[model samples]
Target: MPADRDVLLSARDLHKAYQLGRVDVSVLRGASLEVGRGEFLAVMGRSGSGKSTLLHVIGALDPPDRGSVTLDGQDVFRMPPRGRERIRNRDIGFVFQFYHLLPELNLLENVLVPGMVGRSLTAWVRQRRGLRRKAIELLEKLGLEHRLQHRPRELSGGERQRVAIARALLNEPRLLLADEPTGNLDRASGKAILDHLVELNDGGQTIVMVTHDADVAALAHRCVHLKEGQVTSRHDPRDAERPVQSVSRR
Candidate 1:
Protein backbone atom coordinates (compact mmCIF):
# COMPACT_ATOMS: atom_id res chain seq x y z
CA MET A 1 0.00 0.00 0.00
CA PRO A 2 3.00 2.28 0.01
CA ALA A 3 2.60 5.03 -2.58
CA ASP A 4 6.20 5.11 -3.78
CA ARG A 5 6.82 1.40 -4.24
CA ASP A 6 6.87 -0.16 -7.70
CA VAL A 7 5.20 -3.34 -8.86
CA LEU A 8 7.87 -6.05 -8.69
CA LEU A 9 6.15 -9.32 -9.67
CA SER A 10 3.04 -10.16 -11.64
CA ALA A 11 1.37 -13.40 -12.72
CA ARG A 12 -1.38 -13.58 -15.31
CA ASP A 13 -3.72 -16.58 -15.55
CA LEU A 14 -1.08 -19.07 -14.46
CA HIS A 15 -1.95 -22.73 -14.84
CA LYS A 16 0.13 -25.75 -13.86
CA ALA A 17 -0.65 -29.42 -14.27
CA TYR A 18 1.02 -32.78 -13.90
CA GLN A 19 0.51 -35.89 -15.95
CA LEU A 20 0.43 -38.93 -13.70
CA GLY A 21 0.16 -42.23 -15.52
CA ARG A 22 -2.73 -41.44 -17.92
CA VAL A 23 -4.42 -38.76 -15.91
CA ASP A 24 -3.81 -35.03 -15.65
CA VAL A 25 -3.82 -33.48 -12.19
CA SER A 26 -4.41 -29.80 -12.56
CA VAL A 27 -2.82 -27.82 -9.77
CA LEU A 28 -2.88 -24.13 -10.44
CA ARG A 29 -6.04 -23.20 -12.29
CA GLY A 30 -5.47 -19.70 -13.55
CA ALA A 31 -4.16 -17.80 -10.57
CA SER A 32 -2.92 -14.28 -11.12
CA LEU A 33 -1.45 -11.71 -8.78
CA GLU A 34 0.75 -8.65 -8.64
CA VAL A 35 3.30 -7.97 -5.91
CA GLY A 36 4.85 -4.58 -5.39
CA ARG A 37 8.19 -3.62 -3.93
CA GLY A 38 8.29 -3.30 -0.13
CA GLU A 39 4.96 -5.07 0.06
CA PHE A 40 4.01 -8.00 2.29
CA LEU A 41 1.43 -10.26 0.72
CA ALA A 42 0.17 -13.65 1.91
CA VAL A 43 -1.54 -16.47 0.04
CA MET A 44 -3.75 -18.57 2.31
CA GLY A 45 -5.03 -22.01 1.48
CA ARG A 46 -5.49 -25.48 2.90
CA SER A 47 -3.50 -28.57 1.95
CA GLY A 48 -3.76 -29.56 -1.72
CA SER A 49 -5.01 -26.04 -2.51
CA GLY A 50 -2.15 -25.49 -4.99
CA LYS A 51 -0.67 -22.55 -3.12
CA SER A 52 2.80 -24.11 -2.96
CA THR A 53 2.59 -25.05 -6.61
CA LEU A 54 1.73 -21.48 -7.46
CA LEU A 55 4.74 -20.28 -5.45
CA HIS A 56 7.04 -22.71 -7.25
CA VAL A 57 5.76 -21.50 -10.61
CA ILE A 58 6.17 -17.91 -9.57
CA GLY A 59 9.68 -18.61 -8.28
CA ALA A 60 10.70 -20.00 -11.67
CA LEU A 61 11.66 -23.34 -10.13
CA ASP A 62 8.94 -24.83 -12.28
CA PRO A 63 7.21 -23.53 -15.40
CA PRO A 64 3.49 -23.09 -15.69
CA ASP A 65 1.60 -24.96 -18.33
CA ARG A 66 -0.25 -21.84 -19.39
CA GLY A 67 -0.18 -18.08 -18.80
CA SER A 68 2.82 -15.98 -17.83
CA VAL A 69 4.80 -14.81 -14.83
CA THR A 70 6.72 -11.58 -14.97
CA LEU A 71 9.28 -10.52 -12.41
CA ASP A 72 10.35 -6.93 -12.48
CA GLY A 73 8.60 -6.86 -15.86
CA GLN A 74 10.64 -9.70 -17.41
CA ASP A 75 8.77 -12.80 -18.55
CA VAL A 76 10.03 -15.65 -16.38
CA PHE A 77 9.32 -18.60 -18.62
CA ARG A 78 10.36 -16.77 -21.75
CA MET A 79 13.93 -16.38 -20.56
CA PRO A 80 16.75 -18.77 -21.44
CA PRO A 81 17.82 -21.23 -18.76
CA ARG A 82 21.03 -19.34 -18.08
CA GLY A 83 19.17 -16.05 -17.89
CA ARG A 84 16.58 -17.58 -15.59
CA GLU A 85 19.32 -18.99 -13.43
CA ARG A 86 20.84 -15.55 -13.13
CA ILE A 87 17.52 -14.05 -12.16
CA ARG A 88 16.72 -16.86 -9.73
CA ASN A 89 20.13 -16.46 -8.16
CA ARG A 90 20.36 -12.70 -7.96
CA ASP A 91 16.80 -11.42 -7.92
CA ILE A 92 14.64 -13.85 -6.00
CA GLY A 93 14.92 -15.43 -2.54
CA PHE A 94 13.07 -18.54 -1.39
CA VAL A 95 12.09 -19.93 2.00
CA PHE A 96 10.44 -23.31 2.32
CA GLN A 97 8.21 -25.14 4.79
CA PHE A 98 11.01 -27.59 5.47
CA TYR A 99 14.30 -26.06 6.46
CA HIS A 100 16.26 -27.06 3.36
CA LEU A 101 19.69 -26.36 4.77
CA LEU A 102 22.42 -28.82 3.96
CA PRO A 103 23.44 -30.85 6.98
CA GLU A 104 27.06 -30.89 5.86
CA LEU A 105 27.55 -27.16 5.94
CA ASN A 106 27.52 -24.66 8.78
CA LEU A 107 25.11 -21.76 8.82
CA LEU A 108 27.52 -19.26 7.26
CA GLU A 109 28.59 -21.70 4.56
CA ASN A 110 24.99 -22.57 3.76
CA VAL A 111 24.11 -18.91 3.43
CA LEU A 112 26.97 -18.39 0.97
CA VAL A 113 26.13 -21.37 -1.28
CA PRO A 114 24.31 -19.27 -3.87
CA GLY A 115 27.38 -17.12 -4.30
CA MET A 116 29.46 -20.18 -5.16
CA VAL A 117 27.42 -21.29 -8.17
CA GLY A 118 27.59 -18.60 -10.86
CA ARG A 119 30.29 -16.09 -10.06
CA SER A 120 34.08 -16.09 -10.23
CA LEU A 121 36.01 -16.49 -6.98
CA THR A 122 37.00 -12.81 -6.96
CA ALA A 123 33.50 -11.62 -7.70
CA TRP A 124 32.13 -14.25 -5.36
CA VAL A 125 34.42 -13.17 -2.57
CA ARG A 126 33.30 -9.56 -2.95
CA GLN A 127 29.61 -10.36 -2.74
CA ARG A 128 30.24 -13.23 -0.42
CA ARG A 129 31.73 -11.07 2.29
CA GLY A 130 28.96 -8.53 2.09
CA LEU A 131 26.30 -11.22 2.06
CA ARG A 132 27.99 -12.96 4.95
CA ARG A 133 27.79 -9.77 6.94
CA LYS A 134 24.13 -9.48 6.08
CA ALA A 135 23.59 -13.11 6.99
CA ILE A 136 25.14 -12.60 10.38
CA GLU A 137 23.02 -9.51 10.82
CA LEU A 138 19.91 -11.45 9.94
CA LEU A 139 20.84 -14.24 12.33
CA GLU A 140 21.29 -11.69 15.06
CA LYS A 141 17.92 -10.26 14.25
CA LEU A 142 16.39 -13.72 14.38
CA GLY A 143 18.08 -14.33 17.78
CA LEU A 144 20.47 -16.95 16.44
CA GLU A 145 23.80 -15.17 16.37
CA HIS A 146 25.31 -17.76 18.69
CA ARG A 147 24.61 -20.61 16.33
CA LEU A 148 26.56 -19.31 13.36
CA GLN A 149 28.94 -22.26 13.25
CA HIS A 150 26.29 -24.90 13.89
CA ARG A 151 25.29 -27.34 11.20
CA PRO A 152 21.64 -27.95 10.38
CA ARG A 153 21.59 -31.16 12.42
CA GLU A 154 22.90 -29.34 15.44
CA LEU A 155 20.13 -26.77 15.51
CA SER A 156 16.55 -26.88 16.72
CA GLY A 157 13.68 -26.69 14.25
CA GLY A 158 13.19 -22.99 14.81
CA GLU A 159 16.93 -22.36 14.66
CA ARG A 160 17.21 -24.28 11.42
CA GLN A 161 14.33 -22.30 9.93
CA ARG A 162 16.05 -19.11 10.99
CA VAL A 163 19.12 -20.26 9.10
CA ALA A 164 16.96 -20.79 6.03
CA ILE A 165 15.71 -17.24 6.33
CA ALA A 166 19.32 -16.03 6.57
CA ARG A 167 20.23 -18.03 3.50
CA ALA A 168 17.36 -16.50 1.54
CA LEU A 169 18.51 -13.03 2.54
CA LEU A 170 22.05 -13.71 1.32
CA ASN A 171 21.21 -12.50 -2.20
CA GLU A 172 19.50 -9.25 -1.26
CA PRO A 173 16.77 -10.44 -3.60
CA ARG A 174 14.15 -8.10 -5.08
CA LEU A 175 11.40 -10.58 -4.24
CA LEU A 176 11.08 -13.10 -1.39
CA LEU A 177 8.96 -16.21 -1.78
CA ALA A 178 8.07 -18.11 1.38
CA ASP A 179 6.14 -21.40 1.02
CA GLU A 180 4.43 -22.22 4.29
CA PRO A 181 7.38 -20.75 6.12
CA THR A 182 6.03 -21.46 9.57
CA GLY A 183 4.22 -24.71 8.87
CA ASN A 184 6.75 -26.82 10.74
CA LEU A 185 7.11 -24.67 13.80
CA ASP A 186 5.27 -24.61 17.09
CA ARG A 187 2.79 -21.83 17.79
CA ALA A 188 5.22 -19.55 19.64
CA SER A 189 8.10 -20.17 17.24
CA GLY A 190 5.81 -19.61 14.29
CA LYS A 191 4.83 -16.25 15.71
CA ALA A 192 8.49 -15.40 16.16
CA ILE A 193 9.25 -16.23 12.55
CA LEU A 194 6.24 -14.24 11.41
CA ASP A 195 7.42 -11.32 13.50
CA HIS A 196 10.84 -11.47 11.89
CA LEU A 197 9.25 -11.58 8.46
CA VAL A 198 7.22 -8.51 9.35
CA GLU A 199 10.38 -6.76 10.48
CA LEU A 200 12.02 -7.57 7.15
CA ASN A 201 8.95 -6.23 5.35
CA ASP A 202 9.18 -3.07 7.41
CA GLY A 203 12.75 -2.72 6.18
CA GLY A 204 11.40 -2.57 2.58
CA GLN A 205 11.62 -6.22 1.56
CA THR A 206 9.01 -7.35 -0.97
CA ILE A 207 7.65 -10.66 0.37
CA VAL A 208 5.07 -13.11 -0.99
CA MET A 209 4.37 -15.70 1.71
CA VAL A 210 2.20 -18.82 1.35
CA THR A 211 0.67 -19.59 4.71
CA HIS A 212 -2.43 -21.35 6.01
CA ASP A 213 -2.36 -19.42 9.28
CA ALA A 214 -4.98 -16.71 9.36
CA ASP A 215 -2.95 -14.74 11.90
CA VAL A 216 0.09 -14.92 9.65
CA ALA A 217 -1.97 -13.83 6.64
CA ALA A 218 -3.33 -10.92 8.63
CA LEU A 219 0.21 -9.55 8.98
CA ALA A 220 0.37 -8.94 5.27
CA HIS A 221 -0.89 -5.75 3.70
CA ARG A 222 -3.08 -7.91 1.49
CA CYS A 223 -4.34 -11.48 1.69
CA VAL A 224 -5.50 -13.71 -1.18
CA HIS A 225 -7.25 -17.00 -0.53
CA LEU A 226 -6.80 -19.90 -2.90
CA LYS A 227 -9.02 -22.97 -3.11
CA GLU A 228 -9.25 -25.71 -5.74
CA GLY A 229 -6.31 -24.17 -7.59
CA GLN A 230 -7.99 -20.77 -7.95
CA VAL A 231 -8.14 -17.61 -5.93
CA THR A 232 -11.49 -17.65 -4.15
CA SER A 233 -11.36 -14.40 -2.17
CA ARG A 234 -9.17 -11.45 -1.37
CA HIS A 235 -9.70 -8.80 1.30
CA ASP A 236 -8.30 -7.05 4.34
CA PRO A 237 -10.65 -9.08 6.56
CA ARG A 238 -10.78 -6.22 9.05
CA ASP A 239 -12.28 -3.75 6.57
CA ALA A 240 -15.27 -3.71 4.26
CA GLU A 241 -14.79 -5.71 1.06
CA ARG A 242 -15.53 -2.54 -0.98
CA PRO A 243 -12.45 -0.81 0.49
CA VAL A 244 -10.46 -4.01 0.20
CA GLN A 245 -10.27 -4.19 -3.57
CA SER A 246 -8.44 -7.08 -5.25
CA VAL A 247 -7.83 -8.47 -8.73
CA SER A 248 -9.12 -11.90 -9.67
CA ARG A 249 -7.77 -13.62 -12.74
CA ARG A 250 -9.38 -16.60 -14.42
Candidate 2:
Protein backbone atom coordinates (compact mmCIF):
# COMPACT_ATOMS: atom_id res chain seq x y z
CA MET A 1 0.00 0.00 0.00
CA PRO A 2 2.78 2.42 0.83
CA ALA A 3 4.57 1.80 -2.47
CA ASP A 4 1.49 2.73 -4.53
CA ARG A 5 0.36 5.49 -2.16
CA ASP A 6 1.58 8.30 -4.35
CA VAL A 7 -1.64 8.44 -6.44
CA LEU A 8 -4.90 6.98 -5.26
CA LEU A 9 -7.15 8.96 -7.57
CA SER A 10 -6.58 11.01 -10.70
CA ALA A 11 -8.90 12.99 -12.97
CA ARG A 12 -7.95 14.58 -16.27
CA ASP A 13 -9.91 17.13 -18.28
CA LEU A 14 -13.12 16.04 -16.56
CA HIS A 15 -16.36 17.37 -17.92
CA LYS A 16 -20.03 16.84 -17.09
CA ALA A 17 -22.93 18.42 -18.89
CA TYR A 18 -26.69 18.14 -18.63
CA GLN A 19 -29.39 18.79 -21.13
CA LEU A 20 -31.94 21.46 -20.26
CA GLY A 21 -34.47 22.21 -22.97
CA ARG A 22 -32.16 21.75 -25.93
CA VAL A 23 -29.27 23.48 -24.24
CA ASP A 24 -26.23 21.67 -22.88
CA VAL A 25 -25.46 23.10 -19.48
CA SER A 26 -21.93 22.16 -18.63
CA VAL A 27 -21.26 21.55 -14.95
CA LEU A 28 -17.62 20.49 -15.03
CA ARG A 29 -15.45 22.00 -17.70
CA GLY A 30 -12.00 20.51 -18.05
CA ALA A 31 -11.44 20.01 -14.36
CA SER A 32 -8.38 18.04 -13.34
CA LEU A 33 -7.47 16.70 -9.92
CA GLU A 34 -5.24 14.17 -8.22
CA VAL A 35 -5.44 12.71 -4.71
CA GLY A 36 -2.66 10.74 -3.12
CA ARG A 37 -3.40 7.84 -0.84
CA GLY A 38 -4.10 8.88 2.78
CA GLU A 39 -4.40 12.50 1.70
CA PHE A 40 -7.27 14.71 2.82
CA LEU A 41 -8.49 17.03 0.06
CA ALA A 42 -11.08 19.76 0.26
CA VAL A 43 -12.92 21.28 -2.70
CA MET A 44 -14.59 24.67 -2.32
CA GLY A 45 -16.86 26.64 -4.62
CA ARG A 46 -20.00 28.73 -4.58
CA SER A 47 -23.34 27.28 -5.52
CA GLY A 48 -23.40 26.26 -9.21
CA SER A 49 -19.62 26.00 -9.27
CA GLY A 50 -19.88 22.20 -9.81
CA LYS A 51 -18.21 21.03 -6.61
CA SER A 52 -20.86 18.39 -5.83
CA THR A 53 -20.97 17.33 -9.46
CA LEU A 54 -17.24 16.73 -9.41
CA LEU A 55 -17.53 14.58 -6.30
CA HIS A 56 -20.28 12.47 -7.84
CA VAL A 57 -18.28 12.04 -11.01
CA ILE A 58 -15.24 10.99 -9.06
CA GLY A 59 -17.26 8.46 -7.05
CA ALA A 60 -18.70 6.81 -10.18
CA LEU A 61 -22.25 7.69 -9.19
CA ASP A 62 -22.36 9.80 -12.36
CA PRO A 63 -20.29 9.68 -15.51
CA PRO A 64 -18.51 12.68 -16.90
CA ASP A 65 -19.23 14.04 -20.36
CA ARG A 66 -15.56 13.67 -21.21
CA GLY A 67 -12.20 13.03 -19.58
CA SER A 68 -10.97 10.21 -17.43
CA VAL A 69 -11.14 9.29 -13.74
CA THR A 70 -8.79 6.64 -12.55
CA LEU A 71 -8.95 5.02 -9.12
CA ASP A 72 -6.02 2.89 -8.01
CA GLY A 73 -4.80 3.15 -11.63
CA GLN A 74 -7.96 1.68 -13.21
CA ASP A 75 -10.07 3.73 -15.59
CA VAL A 76 -13.36 4.27 -13.77
CA PHE A 77 -15.49 5.14 -16.80
CA ARG A 78 -14.32 2.20 -18.84
CA MET A 79 -16.10 -0.20 -16.53
CA PRO A 80 -19.61 -1.45 -17.26
CA PRO A 81 -22.50 -0.26 -15.09
CA ARG A 82 -22.50 -3.37 -12.94
CA GLY A 83 -18.74 -3.22 -12.70
CA ARG A 84 -18.94 0.41 -11.64
CA GLU A 85 -21.54 -0.42 -9.01
CA ARG A 86 -19.41 -3.23 -7.74
CA ILE A 87 -16.39 -0.97 -7.47
CA ARG A 88 -18.48 1.63 -5.66
CA ASN A 89 -19.73 -0.97 -3.19
CA ARG A 90 -16.32 -2.46 -2.60
CA ASP A 91 -14.06 0.58 -2.55
CA ILE A 92 -15.97 3.85 -2.13
CA GLY A 93 -17.95 5.32 0.75
CA PHE A 94 -20.09 8.42 0.64
CA VAL A 95 -21.54 10.91 3.11
CA PHE A 96 -23.87 13.78 2.39
CA GLN A 97 -25.42 16.85 4.01
CA PHE A 98 -28.52 14.84 4.81
CA TYR A 99 -28.00 11.64 6.73
CA HIS A 100 -29.68 9.20 4.35
CA LEU A 101 -30.39 6.61 7.01
CA LEU A 102 -33.39 4.33 6.87
CA PRO A 103 -35.99 5.42 9.38
CA GLU A 104 -37.16 1.93 10.31
CA LEU A 105 -33.73 0.34 10.72
CA ASN A 106 -31.62 0.67 13.83
CA LEU A 107 -28.08 1.94 13.57
CA LEU A 108 -26.43 -1.46 13.18
CA GLU A 109 -28.87 -2.52 10.49
CA ASN A 110 -28.47 0.79 8.70
CA VAL A 111 -24.73 0.53 8.71
CA LEU A 112 -25.02 -2.92 7.19
CA VAL A 113 -27.10 -1.79 4.21
CA PRO A 114 -24.24 -1.37 1.72
CA GLY A 115 -23.00 -4.86 2.40
CA MET A 116 -26.53 -6.20 2.02
CA VAL A 117 -27.07 -4.86 -1.50
CA GLY A 118 -26.93 -8.21 -3.35
CA ARG A 119 -27.09 -10.98 -0.79
CA SER A 120 -29.55 -13.16 1.06
CA LEU A 121 -30.34 -12.42 4.70
CA THR A 122 -28.42 -15.35 6.09
CA ALA A 123 -25.52 -14.74 3.74
CA TRP A 124 -25.53 -11.06 4.50
CA VAL A 125 -25.64 -11.68 8.20
CA ARG A 126 -22.89 -14.25 7.98
CA GLN A 127 -20.64 -12.22 5.73
CA ARG A 128 -21.24 -8.87 7.39
CA ARG A 129 -20.68 -9.79 11.01
CA GLY A 130 -17.12 -8.53 10.75
CA LEU A 131 -18.41 -5.39 9.06
CA ARG A 132 -20.86 -4.93 11.91
CA ARG A 133 -18.03 -5.28 14.39
CA LYS A 134 -16.07 -2.67 12.50
CA ALA A 135 -19.10 -0.41 12.48
CA ILE A 136 -19.38 -0.67 16.21
CA GLU A 137 -15.71 0.15 16.55
CA LEU A 138 -16.13 3.17 14.26
CA LEU A 139 -19.15 4.37 16.19
CA GLU A 140 -17.20 4.00 19.40
CA LYS A 141 -14.48 6.11 17.89
CA LEU A 142 -17.02 8.78 16.91
CA GLY A 143 -18.68 8.64 20.38
CA LEU A 144 -21.82 6.92 19.09
CA GLU A 145 -21.50 3.46 20.59
CA HIS A 146 -24.38 4.01 23.00
CA ARG A 147 -26.71 5.11 20.24
CA LEU A 148 -26.36 1.96 18.14
CA GLN A 149 -29.80 0.69 19.07
CA HIS A 150 -31.53 4.00 18.42
CA ARG A 151 -33.41 4.90 15.27
CA PRO A 152 -32.60 7.97 13.24
CA ARG A 153 -35.56 9.86 14.65
CA GLU A 154 -34.37 9.21 18.16
CA LEU A 155 -30.96 10.75 17.52
CA SER A 156 -29.94 14.37 17.22
CA GLY A 157 -28.62 15.75 13.92
CA GLY A 158 -25.01 15.42 14.98
CA GLU A 159 -25.57 11.88 16.25
CA ARG A 160 -27.25 10.90 13.03
CA GLN A 161 -24.37 12.34 11.04
CA ARG A 162 -21.92 10.41 13.17
CA VAL A 163 -23.88 7.26 12.46
CA ALA A 164 -23.72 8.10 8.77
CA ILE A 165 -19.97 8.44 8.98
CA ALA A 166 -19.74 5.10 10.72
CA ARG A 167 -21.83 3.54 7.99
CA ALA A 168 -19.53 5.00 5.35
CA LEU A 169 -16.49 3.46 7.00
CA LEU A 170 -18.06 0.02 7.50
CA ASN A 171 -16.63 -1.32 4.24
CA GLU A 172 -13.10 -0.09 4.97
CA PRO A 173 -13.06 1.92 1.77
CA ARG A 174 -10.01 3.61 0.29
CA LEU A 175 -11.88 6.77 -0.71
CA LEU A 176 -14.46 8.57 1.41
CA LEU A 177 -16.43 11.26 -0.39
CA ALA A 178 -18.40 13.83 1.55
CA ASP A 179 -20.61 16.48 -0.03
CA GLU A 180 -21.32 19.39 2.27
CA PRO A 181 -21.31 17.02 5.22
CA THR A 182 -21.84 19.77 7.78
CA GLY A 183 -24.33 21.88 5.90
CA ASN A 184 -27.27 20.98 8.12
CA LEU A 185 -25.56 21.08 11.49
CA ASP A 186 -24.66 23.84 13.91
CA ARG A 187 -21.13 25.19 14.14
CA ALA A 188 -20.02 23.09 17.10
CA SER A 189 -21.35 19.86 15.69
CA GLY A 190 -19.78 20.66 12.34
CA LYS A 191 -16.46 21.35 14.00
CA ALA A 192 -16.60 18.04 15.83
CA ILE A 193 -17.39 16.20 12.62
CA LEU A 194 -14.51 17.93 10.86
CA ASP A 195 -12.22 16.88 13.66
CA HIS A 196 -13.45 13.32 13.28
CA LEU A 197 -12.62 13.43 9.57
CA VAL A 198 -9.18 14.68 10.44
CA GLU A 199 -8.74 11.77 12.82
CA LEU A 200 -9.68 9.36 10.04
CA ASN A 201 -7.14 11.03 7.73
CA ASP A 202 -4.49 10.84 10.43
CA GLY A 203 -5.12 7.11 10.55
CA GLY A 204 -4.43 6.92 6.78
CA GLN A 205 -7.91 7.17 5.26
CA THR A 206 -8.08 9.12 2.00
CA ILE A 207 -10.87 11.72 1.84
CA VAL A 208 -12.29 14.12 -0.73
CA MET A 209 -14.76 16.59 0.69
CA VAL A 210 -16.79 19.42 -0.82
CA THR A 211 -17.36 22.24 1.60
CA HIS A 212 -18.70 25.76 1.13
CA ASP A 213 -17.12 26.92 4.36
CA ALA A 214 -13.55 28.17 4.15
CA ASP A 215 -12.77 27.19 7.74
CA VAL A 216 -13.75 23.61 7.01
CA ALA A 217 -11.72 23.66 3.78
CA ALA A 218 -8.71 24.85 5.76
CA LEU A 219 -8.70 21.55 7.63
CA ALA A 220 -7.70 19.63 4.53
CA HIS A 221 -4.10 19.50 3.25
CA ARG A 222 -5.09 21.09 -0.07
CA CYS A 223 -8.03 23.03 -1.44
CA VAL A 224 -9.26 23.03 -5.04
CA HIS A 225 -11.40 26.03 -5.86
CA LEU A 226 -13.98 25.78 -8.63
CA LYS A 227 -15.70 28.44 -10.67
CA GLU A 228 -17.85 28.42 -13.82
CA GLY A 229 -17.59 24.66 -14.01
CA GLN A 230 -13.81 24.68 -13.92
CA VAL A 231 -11.13 24.25 -11.30
CA THR A 232 -9.81 27.79 -11.09
CA SER A 233 -7.32 27.59 -8.27
CA ARG A 234 -5.66 25.14 -5.96
CA HIS A 235 -4.41 26.42 -2.64
CA ASP A 236 -2.08 24.57 -0.36
CA PRO A 237 -2.59 26.39 2.91
CA ARG A 238 1.01 25.61 3.87
CA ASP A 239 1.91 27.89 0.95
CA ALA A 240 -1.14 30.10 1.26
CA GLU A 241 1.10 33.04 1.97
CA ARG A 242 2.70 32.83 -1.46
CA PRO A 243 -0.63 33.61 -3.16
CA VAL A 244 -0.81 36.84 -1.15
CA GLN A 245 2.50 37.89 -2.57
CA SER A 246 1.40 37.02 -6.10
CA VAL A 247 -1.84 39.01 -5.69
CA SER A 248 0.09 42.03 -4.39
CA ARG A 249 2.26 41.89 -7.51
CA ARG A 250 -0.92 42.25 -9.58
How many clashing pairs per prediction, in order?
0, 0
Write candidate 2's Cα lDDT for 43-95 as tens digits.
88877778889999999888898999999998989988777887787789999
Per-residue CA lDDT of candidate 1, range 70-180, in tens?
988799899899999988888889999998999899988887787687788899777777777887887788888888888889887878888888888877889989998
* Candidate 2 local Cα displacement, residue 166, angstroms: 0.6
| lDDT for residue 228 in candidate 2, whole number 0-100 | 69
Misplaced by over 4 Å in model 2 are 1-5, 118-123, 234-250
Q: How many Å off is the CA of 153 in candidate 1?
A: 1.2
Q: Rate the local accuracy (lDDT) of all candidates.
A: 0.82, 0.83
